[model samples]
Target: MKTQSRWIGFIAIGMLVLMTVAPAFGAGRPETTATEQVTLRYSWWGGESRHNAFLDVLDMFMEEHPHIRVEAEYGGFSGYRDRLSAQMAANNQPDVFMSGHLPPWDILPWDARKDLSQFDLDLSYYDDTLMATFYAPDGFLIGVPQAGGVGGSYLINATLLDELGLELPSMFWTWDDFAELAQSVYDASGGTVYGALDEAGGVPYANAGPPHFDISYHNTTITNENGLALTADQLRFTYEWWGRLRESGAVSPADITAQADDGANSPIVNRDVAMLPIAMGSFSRFQDNTPDTLVLFPAPAGPNEPFTFGPGMSYQISAHTAHPQEAALLIAFLTNRRETGIRMGTEVGVPASGMYRDLLIEQGLSEAEEAMFELQNWIIANRDVRGDITVHARYNEFRDLVRAEQQAMAFGRQTIDQTVDAVVRHARNLGMNVR
Candidate 1:
């Protein structure tokens, strides 16, 4: 009887130990409910409209997943890149951030972002062609496009055009047609309003000019296996065309064009110009800033009808995040959720996912939003005429260089030929294999 009592005592001690140890072990494991909380930092650059829309989305996300909390870091486009760079260098970047399709962001090293494919994202809702652009050369999916919309268009002030007695250019107009219409607008307006802003040294003009136009007119790539594919003469053609416009007062002067920093101060919004080269994603934002009726037109075609399309922005997860799964979940929620689409509309550009886009359409769209949506569908249907150029890793630097030279030419500090020579020389110095 004493032996039986000792065994029972031992069993009680073991049970007590097991109960204590099991709770300790389970303490480190996250609960499947709100009791286990995860916090994430999300960064992006945009105006107040984008920030407000994103805030609404975040509130909705937190409501659905009560356990996850997202902290938003956002601001205007100015200084955003510098801020992100500083964060990255400190190994303290946000868990998820907005990135553009160009420059330093596009060339971020493979390890800079967590491979998004590892996350439980429903990527089938995304367009395959668009998704391909976000993959690293080594085949890791580095980011997911936030908006798969055409990045370039001619945003014309239809009200201004009507007042000036000028009909809109055809959907299939050419560069020559563009030049003539611009001149006509100048003449009709009695030299008061320029036809378009002088985009001579701007990124938009560069995309529409050397890359798309060169392919159409010269049947040459802007960048090739050899790099900097345009010959000196081919590049000269583009510069000279703009130089002529500047001289004829068909476009804004150097000072006026330089003053156009954003939609608020854009020459078009100010009624200083009738048309502007713009990203289709930001069309609604621009429309909101002005009272005039805005319209979208395709970039003037080259003989070959080549154009470029890319994501307006993409959501990237930091490789250094402690909670990558949660970060990815936020991105997935933004991309695939129906309410997100309805709330976001085209504020972040059109939804990249077809599912969300269809939802937005079914819910109805504002006139400006509908125009952007239809234009994206038009570009996709004509994807065969897409540009065959590659945006280089150093594209941002190259673009700035081109812009500076163009500015010098516009201000009459350099002649067209001199401008061309300087660009070619500097491009080679920048390690572009200018042939």
Candidate 2:
């Protein structure tokens, strides 16, 4: 009777073990506890600061929404478009990506891959101008701008300025005032520094940098309804004026048309240049690179009264994104949220949404950035932000040609009229229908 009872117990135990282990071995592994993870891939081009800031923001985004995972890719500013084109050719584009609208290789065809109308997106959180950059002519907000990259005052070595016993205006300075400042600095430096280290080529056709100030100064852009900037004459005036700076010895001798050797090692970094119009985000970089305290302000005096500081660079979405709606939501959250927006730093443009901008001012920004914020607000309120307009298919080529002319003009090698005509001619030759 004892042995029979023991045998019965053993059989019961074995049966329970089989029931627990059998399902895992049979019929596709018992559904293996499904994982609720959604992965997205995002890419952009920027610096170490930008990359790190972006990673942090994305990490924050992920933490809030544990169901989502993001894979990020970035590189230095140079050769950014090449990577995008190569990746797209491999059909291995990230689920979502960031880009500017120009760079023919990216713009002309990249625009086709997206299908925003079909995507479930929300744009109510973003501002209208910020929405316009990516939208199709009919209407499709391609991406949300990370911020507006506006420029104002140069990082003047106040020690350098005040040491010279010169005083700036109480209110924001105009272009004429800026020229005087540059002149004063140059004179005071006794030729140790040039007033403004002309960044004629900095505003890349491939990328939007502060170099746009030249065109913006003249009330023209690379593209307009009238024609290419050079052809438009109004824009050409600035390039010609740039030539005069060289003639008057207010600028540098380096060829503006060539590659800009900008970094901690450049003349601007050495304080050999009196003025440099770097983005507000990287104002710290200028400080880090220079030997003095740096100050920030608005792009000096608009040629036509006060000027609306236009959107600098934006973080846009791919129209072909399989998860367009989700991507848009991510951007909206990043831009509209006060905390997330401030965490973004100056890596992207200044937050377009006023809500985010307030947070930034409340957080990391230095006195320079705050001062700039105030100046920009004043400009936005007083000047027309929409005063400038952009319209062109071959924007990259157009800007490049203008930059090339700036080089020539700054070097005093070309007449203003000749520079303008040359740029216009090249655009026409490239089959650009610049009106």
Model 1, total clashes: 0
lDDT for model 1 comes to: 0.76
**Residue 14 local lDDT, model 2:** 99
- Indicate which candidate wins on TM-score: 1
User: Which candidate number would show the highest lDDT if scored against the true structure?
Assistant: 1
The residue pairs in collision within model 1 are none
Q: Residue 379 CA error for candidate 1 (Å)?
A: 1.0
Q: Per-residue lDDT tens digits of candidate 2, residues 167-224?
A: 7544566666766777777778786667776655333332322334544465544554
Q: How far is each candidate from the true structure, as Cα RMSD in Å?
A: 9.2, 9.7
TM-score of 1: 0.84
lDDT digits (tens) for residues 142-163 of candidate 1: 7888887765478889998899
**Segments of candidate 2 deviating more than 4 angstroms:** 1-37, 60-67, 85-91, 102-137, 151-155, 169-172, 199-218, 225-227, 232-236, 255-262, 302-309, 336-339, 345-349, 360-365, 412-421, 433-435
lDDT of 2: 0.59
Go through the candidates in order and give each one's C-alpha lDDT: 0.76, 0.59
